[model samples]
Target: MPDFLTLANHCANPRQGTQPNGLPYYDGQGTLTEEMRWLRSFIDEGYLWYKEVPANLNMADYKTVLDYFAVLKTPLITASGQPKDRFHFTYPSEVWEAMSGAGVTLGYGITWSRSTGATPRVYVVTMVEPDSPASKAGVLRGDTLVSVDGADATTSTALAALSPTAAGQTHAFALKRGESTQTFSLTSQKVTEAAVQNTRVISTSTGAVGYLQFNDHNAIAERQLLDAFTTLKAANVSDLVLDMRYNGGGYLLVASELAYMIAGPAATDGKVFERLQLNDKRPPQAPQMFRTVSYGLAPTSLKAGVTLPYLGLKRVTVLTTAGTCSASESVINSLRGIDVEVNLIGGETCGKPYAFVPQENCGTTYFAIQMQGANNKGFGDYADGFQATCKADDDLDHALGDSSERLLATALSYRANGVCPATPLRARSSSSTGPLQLLRPVGKEIALRPR
Candidate 1:
């Protein structure tokens, strides 16, 4: 393969100016076909399973660049019989940048979870964004979607038609919430999703336990986390129930900061939060340390260099599910690395110890696995996902952060008595933010569950 670096930024319709980083685009004479070759070279060199990718496919057989990318992934399967890599894909560079950088998106802010088998598949409201139109329309979490625009939206095909694209796009949703049925009109708009929600100090029998539903590790999450930790710290909480059930994941830096906040200086002072190992061809990169201070990422009031607060707790309870992934798992893994007891409560995580450096060429940004990560303890082989210590059902009946909610309640129970529940919950539905949909799709990260 030739030097793919030489063909970098040589766009078909080149931008004539500098990027936001003040770096000029290395735009040279190029075509779509040339861009594919550049991507091929990059994958051949950097992809984590570079040797596993089929090398015999002709590039001319692909119609679009994205089509080519879809087939360029490793076809290996995990021990659990799941696809080895479902998280490989590309998107418009602009969309990825906006979402990961600022948690920005154009939508009604209703996160969905689908169940199948019957003709009329059930679509449940897994989560609703704070202050979003769906929230304003009184769309509660766990509401079963009955219809879309007065039409039955039970089939998978019908679900595909309910895409929220442009702002001002209006749609009516008929939902079943318990015994009652309600319909609401919602206009799609630009939604700036918040990372932390329902943060509060719960007075448990054991002690004041802090509960916070962390949805993603986007940039906006930095300040929100600081605020939540500050609140929990000020309240003198003895334990924490970090709800990451719906969280996919995002920025590694945010995860490091959060780990430090939970375990504090005594445990995290010199500990590595995540150690990234690139492909065998590349030299080993430096490990990410637990950050005690903020980097002051944008869309927030938190300034850089402020010493972050710490809970200094020896044990932390993390609420998990199949949707919990990437950096979220990093938090669980790193906390365990420092001997900080991380009691998990839900289903297994979305197991992704792998990550990639997003590379943009022409108009689309591509994500291909380039690294496998381990904690300071050097144990990172949970690709099948981290299983729960106490298996709990995702309760749609109770509001999140409510002490009675299944996951949160179970966590509180375990703290009171050091044991899991007698019975495991068989959930009726699970989160359905498949490989194709995720929040913060730009970076080497993920989310439900959102975006």
Candidate 2:
């Protein structure tokens, strides 16, 4: 590191004078947000090197930044700019009504708790899309989520637990419908999950080519992907189109598994996956520990059912945006290391290269942040996000009515220039965009199994 005083003096010189505040701020004060203050202090103290910044300085944590500024970006707003929902969060209550009436697909809907309604005094199923996972799972409109993964459902604890983790596990659910109780089991497979709203299809293409639209790298993602790929292979699908736009990310290993599936045996080429800068207090965990982290399918032999050398499918095109963070970025970062051409689009990514290993100190779960020294591609040094090879309309909501503008179209165009053929299709927007918005791929509706 360079001398801070000398650096500050050099920066303050007439030719390269310091600016007012160039860094993000945190700490919730009306004035003098802590991040900005520290940055200013660093400049004033002549700290020139990047290493001098505090380890806790997370400019990439949007929630922390938003809280520091006392801002809320997801509030529901009407055309007239009036707040639509009293609580700032609102959903379609009609979907709940339809589901309560035993309807199958409720289209797109939202839900909430009510204490006085017909199935009142509990956390009732307030909404359900007609063919969503909740709907397919037979979660009726008035059904009460009693417990999820052993946690009180009303607290959203069980719902949050639905976040994907490594393979070999299951998510348990207990529900109450009328006077009877039932349970459901969500087996995490390697296939991509239904997006947030369980609407859009992330994978769809003509011929041997397959498309996969994934949102998060959750525990079940690996198994879900494996099954999806196997299904695609059985269907004679060869080429692959992976749509990963606005994928804020979930688990890390899920990303690794996806990478290996696309790269096949070629992923063995050592490369970077983004460096993990650790907090001095933490250290790496032993590779042999083999701790059971989440409830989902356990990792199995990638060589299952294969006699010949398993060469995974060739390269893939990864959709990207500023909203893509954590494990999503890790996928792009790692894949690019193995000489895989990651067709980047949209704005700069949410730089979250540090790997968070879950740990428990006193009953409280803490995420011990560390960085990948290297990925399977052996390209871990590249950080601060990869620059986009091309750009697209990241503001999908604004482009919904604009027929000529689409990020997926741009991605497909680029795909055609490579080994994949151009297909006349539209990519899904996001998982949370609703099921009616989901691109229908494969799968059939089955009766909800009782837990």
Candidate 3:
């Protein structure tokens, strides 16, 4: 297998730079001289921030290489100039395969958000995968986890550790609901997450409102979304509320297809959904076009397709949060680009106009930011995130997709009154306008899964 240095040189964006200097021709190991030379050559050819790299940094140390890469992030000037590069990271190949290929993860099947306030922290359930351990154990969105295996669930580290890595492992959870605390014991299992959590037609005085709690943008989501829209269309729904509160995003193709479904053939017949801009070193690729429904994941296999059931909607209400990112943001941006109204409810989106094509090296998958995505008008610099049109709390106290949920209710209120409800002073103080935090265990990367 090629060493890390060689793989880094071949795959890193920019693909050319200065070499690092160091000692150690042979640190008690054979042929240190050749290894050091190769390291210098790799750095010179592939380091994106070669000019900023310290000349005296140890060239042969893998840690040194990673440390250098960490600091050499290109600052995105549009995002309030915050020196953040959270998009770059590496994970084990097995993790990448499970998450990208199967949408599987070892846990109790609950996605959560941690509160940043005082001690004895609160960990609230954001979404629960259907039929997963968490759901089976009676977990619901907005359930405040008071304790996890007897430990307080306030800290992020504590909350993360609650996710079991091994199957059949049991953990105790004490959740607070309606001023009462209840305990449930759940055994961990390999959860295959369903992208579409819940879909129903809500009848109100105005008309039928299609409510879809879309959790992830994985490949299976393509079929799930098609089915959801098919039902909605059959019901003759007039409006849509796409709940993407806990969706961190997955495939761009799915995003495009969704935009096409909402806007329909008339608005998207020949429209550009998103445009990708590559590094100056590579040739620019064609813009991604809005696509109709297809049976398979690949574009060429659309022969078995039916006419996509589009809402033909000129406007849509999207439920968002800090967890709404990447492909999720893409859908919002693309729709707005084509003159479609996107009424954002809840918190600001996690500003990530950038994306990556996962590259494997030394049995690890590296998600390096390589491209920027813009809409038809070429306005894709939302590193500071898209602010909400109507601010509302997540209202973990109520179930998602419920008519009474704060965010959902706010959207419905806007639909009826054509005005944003006054954001309560308390809700505004706890909104997601603060600095973005990494919501999921894995870093964000938008790519097509292996078919």
Best by lDDT: 1
- Please list the residue runs of candidate 1 whose C-alpha ends up more than 4 Å from where it truly belongs after superposition: 15-29, 116-119, 155-157, 426-451
The CA lDDT of each predicted structure is: 0.81, 0.42, 0.71
TM-score of each: 0.92, 0.44, 0.82
Model 2 ranges with Cα > 4 A deviation: 1-207, 269-311, 361-364, 376-378, 381-383, 395-405, 418-451
Tens digits of lDDT, candidate 2, 42-92: 322321122333345434453332232222222345564653221111112
Q: Per-residue error at 278 for model 1, in Å?
A: 0.7
Write one digit per residue (lDDT tens) for candidate 3, span 1-451: 3343543423222212321223222111224333434444433433333343456655445443344444444444334656545576667656776776567888888877766654444567767888888888888876767887777776554565676668898878899876899998988888898878679999999899999998777756777788899999999999999998777778887888898999898888778888987654457788888878664552332333656679999999999888888889999999999999999998898887876666553334556566688997798988778999988767766677889888899999999998987643133215443222334675433533222
Clashing pairs in 1: 248-447, 249-446
Give model 3's TM-score versus the native structure. 0.82
The most accurate candidate by TM-score is 1
lDDT of 1 by residue, 48-143 (tens): 888899989788999877888888888988777888987887878777878777888877888776664444456778778889999999999888
Clash count (model 1, backbone only): 2
Candidate 3: regions farther than 4 A off: 1-58, 64-72, 75-81, 154-160, 298-307, 425-438, 444-451
